[model samples]
Target: KEDYNRNRPHSSLGNITPNEFAMKIAMEKQAA
Candidate 1:
């Protein structure tokens, strides 16, 4: 269950993996 939650792509986040989405958001914040 934990693995699935961390590894799955989400439709709400543009179909990217959760980790990828998180990293993307973090990068955006750093850029700002």
Candidate 2:
């Protein structure tokens, strides 16, 4: 449900939650 989408870690995303992956990507973009 909503909780899973917001907090579950996904294997495809290097075992990170969706929000974490998004933040990681954002930080990488900023660094670049």
Candidate 3:
């Protein structure tokens, strides 16, 4: 999880910061 959660480019968020990347996913799920 650490590898995916950090040290990598997040394609879904268009390569945003890792912490931001994870937050975006979380927010999207909560919205759903």
Better of 1 and 3 by TM-score: 1
Root-mean-square deviation of candidate 3: 3.8
* lDDT top scorer: 2
Q: Write the per-residue lDDT of candidate 2 for residues 1-32, one digit (tens) a residue.
A: 99888799999999999999999999999999
- Off by more than 4 A, model 3: 1-13
Q: If the candidates were sorted by their TM-score against the true structure, best first, what order would they fall in?
A: 2, 1, 3
Candidate 1 overall Cα lDDT vs. reference? 0.92
Stretches > 4 Å off in candidate 1 = none
Compute the lDDT of residue 16 as modeled in candidate 1. 90
Greater lDDT among 1 and 3 belongs to 1
lDDT minimum window of 10 residues, candidate 2:
2-11
lDDT tens digits by residue: candidate 3, 1-32: 78677867777769776887778889999999
Native-structure RMSD, model 2: 0.8
Best by TM-score: 2
- Candidate 3 lands at a TM-score of 0.52
Q: Any residue pairs clashing in model 1, and if so which?
A: none
